[model samples]
Target: MEAVPLEHILLLGAVLFSLGILAVISKRHAVVVLMGIELIFNAANLNLVAFSRYDPSLLQGQMFSLFVIVVAAAEAAVALAIVLRVYQYFKTANLNEIVSPENK
Candidate 1:
């Protein structure tokens, strides 16, 4: 397979990162925020893989990317679980209405 240019991957990452940032800022839902966080993580992973492809001396970045994926998976699982719990307790998932006692 022909290798893609690093600059292309960087540009893609930049675009994804910007979109993720926008999503996080514009969305009021917790799930949407989580999706944005996932997008940001993927953007970072794309950059890592791009660097690993260009630098043949080490595979550390690629390995780190793998770890990041695993961690992201775990994070998503835990975050979803929390969201479910909150929904069950509150009967709503609106970010504005969900507040802790300390905040109230």
Candidate 2:
């Protein structure tokens, strides 16, 4: 069986990254933005694993991706907690509408 080409993996990662960027830019909700951030992180992880596949002796890419996964999990938890608080106070998750009291 022929192994997948690195260029294809890189292209896929690039597409994922671009989609994540678009979602972050176009979405208004905080949770959606967070999801976009996760997508970006996943894209990076995919590229890392793909590059590391060529050199199995060095597991740096896999290790780094694991670290990123842990960090991303922590980030998602904290971000959701903050979003929950914002929602409780503002009664809405729309970032554009969640202005400060001073601004209102």
The per-residue C-alpha lDDT of model 2 at residue 37 equals: 98
**Candidate 1, after superposition: displacement of residue 95 in Å?**
0.7
Q: Which stretches of candidate 1 lie over 4 Å from their true place?
A: 102-104
Q: TM-score of every model?
A: 0.90, 0.97
lDDT of 1 by residue, 17-101 (tens): 9999998999888899899999999999999988887688899889999999999999999999999999998787778889886
- Give each model's whole-structure lDDT: 0.92, 0.98
Residue 63 shift from truth in candidate 2, angstroms: 0.2
Give the per-residue lDDT digits (tens) of candidate 2, residues 1-104: 99999999999999999999999999999999999999999999999999999999999999999999999999999999999999999999999999899989
- How well does candidate 2 match the true structure in TM-score terms? 0.97
- Residue 9 of candidate 1: its Cα lDDT? 90
Question: How far in Å is the alpha carbon of 35 misplaced in model 2?
Answer: 0.6
Which residue segments of model 2 deviate by more than 4 Å?
none
